[model samples]
Target chain A: MIARLVGDAAGVMSGGVLIGPGDDAAVWQPPPHRAVVVTQDALVEGEDFRREWITPHQLGRRCLAVALSDLAAMGASAAWCTATLCAPAETVLDDVLALALGLREEAEATGCRLVGGDLSGIRGPLVVDVCAGGSVEPERALRRGAGRVGDVLAVTGTLGGAAAGLRALFGRRPPAAAPAQVDAWVETWRRPRARLIEGRRLAALGVRCAGDLSDGLLVDAERTAAASGCRAELRLEQVPLAPGLRTAFPDAWGELALGGGEDFELLLAAPRPLLERIALDWPPELAPITPVGVLREGSGVSLYADGAPLPLPRVLSRHFA
Target chain B: MIARLVGDAAGVMSGGVLIGPGDDAAVWQPPPHRAVVVTQDALVEGEDFRREWITPHQLGRRCLAVALSDLAAMGASAAWCTATLCAPAETVLDDVLALALGLREEAEATGCRLVGGDLSGIRGPLVVDVCAGGSVEPERALRRGAGRVGDVLAVTGTLGGAAAGLRALFGRRPPAAAPAQVDAWVETWRRPRARLIEGRRLAALGVRCAGDLSDGLLVDAERTAAASGCRAELRLEQVPLAPGLRTAFPDAWGELALGGGEDFELLLAAPRPLLERIALDWPPELAPITPVGVLREGSGVSLYADGAPLPLPRVLSRHFA
Candidate 1:
């Protein structure tokens, strides 16, 4: 399979890709203002999703959304995208069109249009790979390398809902039903809101350090710290969790918040003054920007439960990793 | 496997994607640009390639080259690129770095960059998916829809060398031992070049109907005809075949030329006046553009073999559906 083939060739190619994978788009800065970004992610059936958990429409929407989220992380807007589809010949044309429609709708929401792509027949399972593009200004672009000492780290939304939703769907213990009110946690996993708006807002605020929290807060925070050569200390109490998550799985909600993946929210940082201004403009519901911690002059990332330093988990999560 | 999972969900969806997964790239005309061109192709080990046929570096270069061919057909410049790699966990680190270096070299050759990409470990086979981006002037972008009746068909490069190289490699007959020259044919298959210069030059000559001939000329010509609601009358004698192809397999050369794939050349059409100008500007060595046929105001594609209409093949050749 193509996915397996990709795994065979994927190794850490240091200093080869200026921007490695894991952004809304991957950019290569050519001469002049001709900068462009390309992004791709593959969604595999029974692995990335299940029909019982998502319809074709929602499935298509999620596939494009995740790829587009990479662009948002780079502080770039998605301009275009492509998809490679492999499915059985017996699949209905309407279902395929619905997938197309779903992709189109999500792409348009991000101000993109479906330009072109490929479709093929396969004997087993289905896979969709989406690639998106965007342009970046030379002077203003943000990257994982730009975090500074004492910069205030913040996130655009709360976490743990998507994992909770999965738990709810899988009927882990009590087989809970989805709540009727605006459940941000489940929504984050089902239909992640790419932080383009918040990215632009942060960009306007001259915040140079940023990344998306797709691989959970702790792991991504560790990455930011390692990439920026600074130590990130997060206030465990300040780290927001989904409203109902703590009540539902009281023991593991915190672990899910710290270690669960696929939240797709923005993790950005700025100096103290800019952080204060951002907190004022941010809406608590949509994106409650909060100061979780500071970037210290050191290496590696750490967590603080109250005033005591906590050990970071060593086991990598299966999904994002 | 991930491929099975992707195939099952068919595709992912979120709100706002306008057109996803069927075109060149997801075209989000966000803000400044009204039209954007994107393209992608995946190369799999034990399928599209073998280490004996290509180096990891050449594999990386070829992935970008194949995807860029689509951009070239659209008369666009190569701007950005991303790669998704799946390989073995124990693969040597240098092989991975060399692949990135090769991608970087090619990106620089075509004024592009290696932006972002993903890496993962899988059981077997290696797949490299290259996604590329380019920009088109909204007013002047070419498409498969613009092939007009009376338009003369043309091609940009020599054909059949890549397939010939495959035969030479596998020893279907006595192998060609002239290592230096035979290597060129092998390179045609292993490291095909995108005709970006030729595309821009043709576009400058007012040629708007075009497509890359990734799957033999016969198949792509049919695509142009079908999309444009016109019929293509290909002059078999006028088709350009590489020198050694005819000599090595004289009786079967025509079939190989007609059905063989992975030439990465352009198959386009324009008015007679425009054709003359395009021919004048196109490099004779790299492309040697030639007029091969004309579009009729009808449907379906056809071939004229020895001054008689012949039954056309329905399916394209290997690796492409």
Candidate 2:
């Protein structure tokens, strides 16, 4: 059944995939003069998603997107990916087929090939682990350690939508929002897109420091600061919140914007002049880039609202305690 | 705890690893003029192993070896690997650290590097998935479709040891082996080694078709035959049995040797003269190569015992039904 599903979803191979499925391993001839960037991420059924909240197709695409976000964070172009799915024997074959199809679609959309994968029967929750590899010019690749003092911190797209969506999915008190707004939030949560174009442009524009907003702004900002030996200071008022987020949760909008995870947006750091130039030349098709913070000669992260000091909210991390 | 464990296990990096842990993704510079071979394998708690059957250290090493076997089958040198471990929150941090240590040890021993990984909290069983990447000459890669009619089939190292070891661990009817022999069998099962040296030697010797004996001889041979559009004729009497295996299970040795899985040995196919030439130049330090079969113009696999046709045993797959 797994073989049939893989065959049905194989589709037309792209990139430089020389050996695809049904081999001991997939072989690919990577482009020359490029470094390979690799990352692995996994989503367990209960921990990462609820079956009722996501279809198998959405889950499949979401898994690849989550892993690809790391490559985006590194400013690497998508190349290929391999996935491992562990499901219960009782799982419907159609679900598996739909999941593989979704994966194939996402791979094709991102210019990557679903070269190979493994499937197995499990006695517990479904587990999807994806390992993505991409190529990047080594000298121009983005790094967390490249932030400098007085550098401006910018983010692509709006934040807090996915967090709002999660609340809509699991919060006991239903958000007081219009149905259309709620649906938009849910859509953001279900299918967060990796900012691939924005990431590549950053690298092309000579920006060196950036990371994905998978763990929200506050946590990721702090991480970037620590890696670069500096501090992150955010102007809360400048943060671009998702549409209707402030209206949906007047009191909690700040929390969601600062602590909500899975935004899948790129957080970049560069000199103010360079950032201004990038904004002037940014493509209209890509998400809008907004300056939200700056790096300073200190440690940790700080927040300010309308130039007034604001206390930091309790941050919830995705993995770290 | 995961961060600290990774930090402690992050030894001096090698194998073109430019960026190791504590990053969005690892960056590696691959050797020029080579193709990248990639494979992913996972070991789940209930499906692939049990807590009572193996130590954390052994499990760690075993997981990496399993993935590396795929690269070996393609005659790719070990390069680097990333792993994801999903465990319940109640899991002991010490065990996780020990497992990482074991992985690091194996990586260093095999001239590979542990570049990056993910650690997650699970609600159910432990899950460890590993993705390994290596460089191989595209023109010289060992492939399943490269076998030809009249090619002599050879395998490195002896078979059935791991199977016998598994039997000693879980068989309903215990074999009549001595305590020392049983201990050896258990050790063999617990610490299977990937035939990396033998695989590289085969590729260097211009051998074309090869695969790892991950699913025992019968199943893998059948797969090779189907891939190459030829029949695999096995001389059952010529197969090299693990020491004391036949003595321990005289009635079941054939089945175990031909049908049992998880033996990390290499199976190769080449013409008679080429096989003899490779044998003449085989390194003494590597595992011994033994001829046990031949490829013919037909389909499926056939077995002969002492010059007489023998019935194939019921092959039990590790995962597929």
Candidate 3:
């Protein structure tokens, strides 16, 4: 059965993959003069998703996107990925095939290839672990430790949509919003896009420090700040909320914007001048880049609203606490 | 808790790892003129192992070893590894820490660094997935597709040990073997070594076709044969059995030798003169390399005993079927 799945998924190899699936290990001839960026992310059933909320296909695509978000955080080009799926023996074959198809589709969409992976039967929750590898100019690669005290903190795309989406997903009653509005939020929750192009653009535009907003803006910002020996001072009003988020959440929009995780957006830090220049020359095709904060000469993260200090909300961790 | 474990296991980084754990992704500077070899393997709670049979530390080491074996099969020098562990929320934190310690120990022993990984809570079972990366000269990397007709089939280290060890583990009654002998088999089952040095030696000796015998000799040899478009003919007498294996399972020794999986040894196909040369130049410090079979002008694998064709044993799949 494993061999059959691999065979069915064969012949989709991209250039540079010397040996794809069906080998002991996949070999890739990486492009010369670039360092490899590698990251591994796993999503487990119940913890990462509920079957009722996500189709197998969406789960597969989301898993790859989550893994690739790390590469994006590193400002690296998409290259190849390997995935391991641990499912129960009772899992439907078509569901597994659909999951694989989703993975292949996402890989192709991102200019990456699913070169190899493993499958196993489990007596536990379904687990999808993906290891993504990409290449970047070593000196130019974005890093969390590169943030400067005076750097302007920026984010690509609007935030808080996934969190809003999650709220809509688990709400006892349907959201008091238009059907299209509810659909948009649900879509954001189901299919968050990794800002790969925006990340590469940031690297090319001389941005040094960055990370993906998988753990929400506050936690990820704090992490970047801690890594760089600085503090993240986020201006709440400057945060670009997803359309209708303010209207949907009203009282909790601030918490959602600051703490809602799984956004998969890129958070970047660069000098004010460079950020201004980037904003001026940023391509319209990519997600809009918004300056939402600044790196200050301190440790930890601080939030401000209307020029007044605000206490950080105690948001529950989305995964294992 | 995750951060604490990562920090405690820190400082074991080897050179070439630019950005290790705690970053969004790990970055490594690969040596010039080498292709990257990557492989992923996962172990589930009940499928790959049982909690009673293996300690958390052993499980961690085994997971990394399983992944590194694929790199070894490609004759690649280990560089870095990332692992994901999904445990139930009720799992003991100490056990998780011990597992990380084991992973660090094995990675250091293999001259690779633990770069980055993910952690999540699973409601069902424990899952550990490891991804290993290494570098090898593209022209010299061993591949199963390189096998040719008339090539001698060889393997590194003893066979049937893991299978015998597994039998000892699952046996309801104590085996008739001596306690010391039982201990050895159980050890082999719990801690299989990846033949890194032997694989490199084979590659250096110009042997191209190879694969790790994780699925026992018969199955892996058949896979190699199928991949290379040749037939594998095994000489049962030539197979080097684990010490006391025949004495332990007299009637079943043949099946154990031919069908036992989890051996974690290398199966290679090379010309007779090359095999002889390899044997002559084999390093005394590495695992012993022994000739076991030959490749013919057909497909599939065949077994022989005392010059008579023997039927292949139907071995149950060790992993998910």
Candidate 4:
């Protein structure tokens, strides 16, 4: 079944894969003189998402997007991915194949191949776990702990779109959200792309510290701060909110941008000069970056609106928090 | 929680890993001259094993063994592994930590490092999926399609133990089955080892076609034959059954040995001279190999009892069959 689904890996991702999909395992002759970065992430049916909100295809694509987000944060170009999908026996074969197709399509788009995987029966919620591997030059990968005390923090693209989408899907509403805005947010939530190209740009520009905003910017910023042994001070007013977020979510925009997770955006930390240089060199094709915070010599994360202090918002991520 | 559990990737597996845990992803500088082999396997709580039959530690170890078994078949050496574990909210922290320790211990034993993973809350049964990566010499991998007509089929270690063990676990009746034998079978089911050493030996010894006997011999032999475009003929009388299997469940022994899955042994196919040479040079330290069958210019697998044709048994693997 897996072989039929995998077919042939859509060409090799960088250094050609020697064995494609069929043997007991997949073999790749990696790019010479480079380091390999690997990460894993999983999405559960009820815990991470719901069937009503996202189709099997979207969910499957989300698995690779989420997993590859880690590689993106590391400034690694994806080479291979393995996805293990466990579903109940009654699940339709077409849906399963569609999900597999979703993963395969995204992999091909990202220049990665579906190398190997296992499909099994689960008497529980549908589970899709994806492991993505990529390559980076030695010592060139971005890292959370590489953040410095005086580093300015910036983020690629925008935030709050997915959070707003979740709210719209769950019917948590205000006076009213425009139908077009709601649909856009829902699309963002359904298909979050990893910032692989932007990450490579950052690494090439010598930006050191970075992490993905899967658990919202504030939470991930705090984590990055802690890992770097520095405190984080964020200017919420400066954050680049997703398009129409401020208009559609006038009241809850702050919370959604800061606490609502799964944006798949990247949080980058570097000195002011380096960040400015990267911002200038960044092409129009890449996800744009906007400075929103700074790392400081303190212990915890602090929030501010302009010059005034503000309390941290409630975290909406369901990560055992 | 995962940070506390993973602490540090015990030690580098082969060529040292550049970046350890506690990052967006783990970075490894693999042995510069070898092709990397990767595989994934997952174990669901109820579908794969019952909690009553194995402890959390054993289950965790079982996950790695099953995953690395694929690497073993590919003649790859264990290097780095990532384990994603999803459990219900009610699960104890200690148990999860214990399971992590089991994976860590087994990885260390196999000379692999626990690089990175994700922990998530599932609303239903526990799920553990592992991705293991290893290094193999270029063009030295044992492949399923490498088999040729007149090639002899062999297996490393004994088969049927796991199948018999599964039967024992399910309490399939026996007329006064020995206590010692039952315990041994149960142990075998609980702790099946991957034949990594034997696999590397085979590759080093210039042997080619091979695959793991995760499924029973007959089914796997059929798969090998189909992949290689040849016919497999197995002599049931010359087969190796788990010790005491014939005496314990005399009536079911044939089915268990031939149809039972999860044995995690390596089923190898090579020409007669190579098999004989491998058998002669086989070390006591490695799992013993025994000749069992032969490949011919035909299709499908055929079974015989000391040259008398026999009907194929029902496949006992619960893999959507």
Candidate 5:
């Protein structure tokens, strides 16, 4: 089809492309002394986001951020990104362009360039897919597969804040909905920061096996444990939930604390012997780094509250079904 | 908000990804390679495609193939890919899943891995976007700026077949509508092959200036000339048009020959001296490569029929105003 030619030509020539759009494939070279790491993700309106909850600009930023965070988790520095948007003709072209501008700003803020993107008129929900490229030295890279049986599982920043903030946006009375907590949670939820700096710090410390908590403590932790082939038993007493979260929705608080997604915090697995060194640079007061569990030579995730196993939540996201 | 976390975490890392997603800033390591080239593109039903014209699997393949063609023209390879799809809910999940499977198959056909991607629910139209990556050795990739004066412009495949096929699909009478020509044109248009092999061949031959003909011949040639700061003059008689195309639309044959798009052929410029040595593999039968024009030391594109300047028809596509 015409598409085959379009696809083939865009990636054809192997070399001699200072910047080719087609040939066998495409090639991108980052600066010297750096290896490129790539990441990609897609977002669909209604399922992944809502127009009522996010502006186009915010959506752009979020789309870019998610892909960027993958690089951060790998301890790689973002260099360039590409975003593709599919929307209806009735959608404001100006707003869409503005969203691209916002992406440019956010990427530039992180010293990354928003190099190129694609826009198309489609009949379904608006979709944005982003690809982020970063430069990282092989030695300093981190991976989810590097955790050991004895590594200590620590998290940076507060947990459940994003989930709590979401509840507020949805008009749900989450236990963490105390006025002050809600404000804090909403801010965290709306634009959770990317822990790029911490990733570099951890990398420098020779730490590996790290991931950002996007699918809540339970799901993400399970992913890490599964990927690393280890078992993790989280201590609920040690699990950090927003203050008053338990008091408000007494029944669901534990569920939110366990399965609430979108915390966006980094769940790191490090050797217990290095705890003192890890705590040196990061203080509990500034970005509270808490250890909630330990890895073991087994499988499955177990959550304990007051020394008893709690019932697992039936659903994680409303859109999943 | 959760999407923000997903976006931030799924992208590249920079030293400043502070609590990225849920933290302050994320930390990342700088790799050994720098300078990256990126591109993105999207597809939508009705505007660029129609379900009646192709199968869902073919549609998915075409969507990615078309976007990757841009990378091919840049002389690169696919390092990774991210795709987004938006379709109606009533649509069977398996159908969409089949599309994903097709995408994966196409990706594997080319030598890249599907690192990560996203999927979500939507309402009416079906949309997809693909972002691919390629790595170039320092100072080896080609760009659109290298077309020099006296360069011979060439193409890798036949032209107008796709355009002719479009007419045929709609039951329009065209010169190429005769059984033999119509079959060739329709088949070519339905699954136009990517000239990846030819791109590599050209790259090995040291051909520098090149681009895919996503737009019609005249338009893309003009773009190459304009972007390269040179004038291009093409002899109309030397232009290639499917045989049936001449027979089908004989009155406006020249317009269709030079202006109709969606051919996906590689319209490239080669140094003058390489013409003879380069043409040995031009094979006039299948994908007959031809020299239709020469880059001049001036600006703008001029057409010649029997050594006299000829008025050219505009070949254009939908672009945001």
Candidate 6:
């Protein structure tokens, strides 16, 4: 079944892929002298998505994007990907092919070849797992542990929209007047864009510490801090919320923005000097970079509002604090 | 959860692994100037194995072995692997950890690094998917399409043991007198070994066409034939039967040996001269090779018994022919 998917994966030619699916494995050549940054991520049916909320095609694109987000954080070029799909026996072949097509489209969008994968029957919820990798110059790849004590934290694009979209997807019918904004939020949740360009730009600008906002700000912030041996002091007032997120869920926007997760945006930390230079040369069309926090000589993450430490939220879940 | 597994994956370090699990992704430096062979394979709970039948540790080992088999077929030296697990929320942490330990053990045994992965909640049975890769010499890796019409087909190791083991596990209680052999067969099914060494030997010996017999001899032979644009002709009488398989089930041995998948053996097509040379130099420590078939100027597969064309098995499954 996996070998057959190679026929459907008619993707634009990428430089490194020497063999695409249908054999014992796919073979590729990484650029000479470049280190490979690899990551694997998965989305389960019930836990990650509801069938009624997202089409198979969208789910396909979303899965690839989610995995690619890690490569984005590493500031690696999109090169190749392999996906494993475990679906029920009753699943229609067309659905499987549609999912493959979704993967192909995403690969085309990112220039990552959908090289090879495995397919198997499952007795439960659908599972799509993708392993993505790309090349980065040795010793220059961004890492979470590379942050410094005085590094300022900045993020690509806004946050909380995907989480808000998830809430709206469940039971929170948006205010009728704000239906359009809610739809856009839902779209953001459905189709995530990996910040590949911004990540490269940051790396080129000499930003070495970075990670993706897959689990939203609070968790990823705490993680980056723990890895970098410092504290993430997030200034809530300075954090940029997704457009209309504050207006749609005025009471819960803070928690949603901090904890809602599913935002494929990147959070980067660099010396303020580099951050200033990056800001000065940042392209106007790219997702606007906004200062959100700083790495201090502490541990974990501390939330502050108006320069005063705000108590951590009771829980950073879909329910919002 | 994936980040936590990195703590459990204390593995024997192989060269080129710059990073292991944890962080957003794992970083690795492939052998400089070597092409990479990447493959992904998955084992879904219930469909692939019932928890009652195999221990979590064995399942973990099996999953990694299954994915590694593809790399083995490519004659790529195993380098690194990433696993994604989707387990029910009710799953015990110890089981998950045990599974990770299993993966680590297999990686240690094979000299592959269990570098990184992703963990997620699933509403259904557990699913473990692994993406494994290794470096191969550019333009030198074995491929299914490299066979010629007149090449004789040879397989490493005996066939049908794992499939027969599957039947034995399913209440086909082997003849009580053969309990010891039956037990060994069962072990073969529970713990698969990728023929990595033999594959590397084949490549070193200049064998260009080979693939793992994961879906049994019939399916895999057909696939290799199709990929090479030729027909496969097998002499059933010369084909190897797993030790004790023929005696245990004389009537079904042919079908089980032909169609029962998961053998994880390698089938190769090479010129007669190369086969003779390989046989002379084949190591006694490795699984014995047996010539069972030949590639011909046609499509599909033809089975012969005592020099007479034999009808293909009615069905190649646990039920036998």
What DockQ does model 2 achieve?
Answer: 0.72
Runs in model 3 with CA error above 4 Å? A1-13, A172-174, B1-3, B7-13, B172-174
lDDT of each: 0.67, 0.86, 0.86, 0.87, 0.66, 0.85
Give the CA lDDT, 0 to 100, for residue B300 in model 1. Answer: 76
The stretch of ten residues in a row with the least summed lDDT in candidate 5 chain B is: B16-25
lDDT of 2 by residue, A163-282 (tens): 888778775334479888887888898898888778999999989999998899999999999889999999999999999989878889999899887778888899999998888979
User: Which prediction has the highest DockQ against the true structure?
Assistant: 3
Worst 10 residues of 3 chain A by lDDT: A1-10
Report the C-alpha lDDT of model 1 over A1-321, residue by residue, as the tens digit: 222211222334221122222211122222234334456787766556666777778878898888877777767766656676655557787677778778878877887655556655544456677876665553455666688888988887777777766655555632243465224555566887777767766776688878777677887787788768898888888878877676667667677777766777777768899888777767555566767888998887788989998877543263532
Model 5 misplaced regions, further than 4 Å: A1-28, A31-34, A173-183, A242-251, A283-287, A318-321, B1-37, B171-176, B179-183, B252-256, B281-287, B314-321
Candidate 4 DockQ vs. native: 0.77
Quote model 6's iRMS: 2.6
DockQ value of candidate 6: 0.70
Instruction: Give the per-residue lDDT of model 2 (tens digit) for B10-90.
Output: 456678888888778888888899989999999998888888889999999999999999999999988999999998889
Docking class of 2: medium
- Pairwise TM-score winner, candidates 4 and 6: 4
Ranking by lDDT: 4, 2, 3, 6, 1, 5
- Once fitted onto the true fold, the runs of candidate 4 whose alpha carbons sit more than 4 angstroms away are A9-15, A318-321, B9-15, B318-321
Residue by residue across B1-321, what tens digits does model 3's lDDT show?
A: 555655543464455887788778988888999988999999898888888889999988899998999999999999999999998888898899999888888898998888889988888889999999999998999998899999999999898878777877786323667878877878887898888888887898899999999888999999999989999999999999999888877788888777777889999999999888778867788999899999999999999988999989886466723
RMSD of each: 9.3, 1.8, 1.7, 1.8, 7.0, 2.2
Q: What is the lDDT of residue A146 in candidate 2?
A: 90
Q: Could you arrange the candidates by DockQ from highest to lowest?
A: 3, 4, 2, 6, 5, 1
Q: How much is B50 displaced in model 3, in angstroms?
A: 0.6
Q: How many backbone clashes can be found in candidate 5?
A: 133
Q: What C-alpha lDDT, on a 0 to 100 scale, does residue A110 get in candidate 1? A: 84
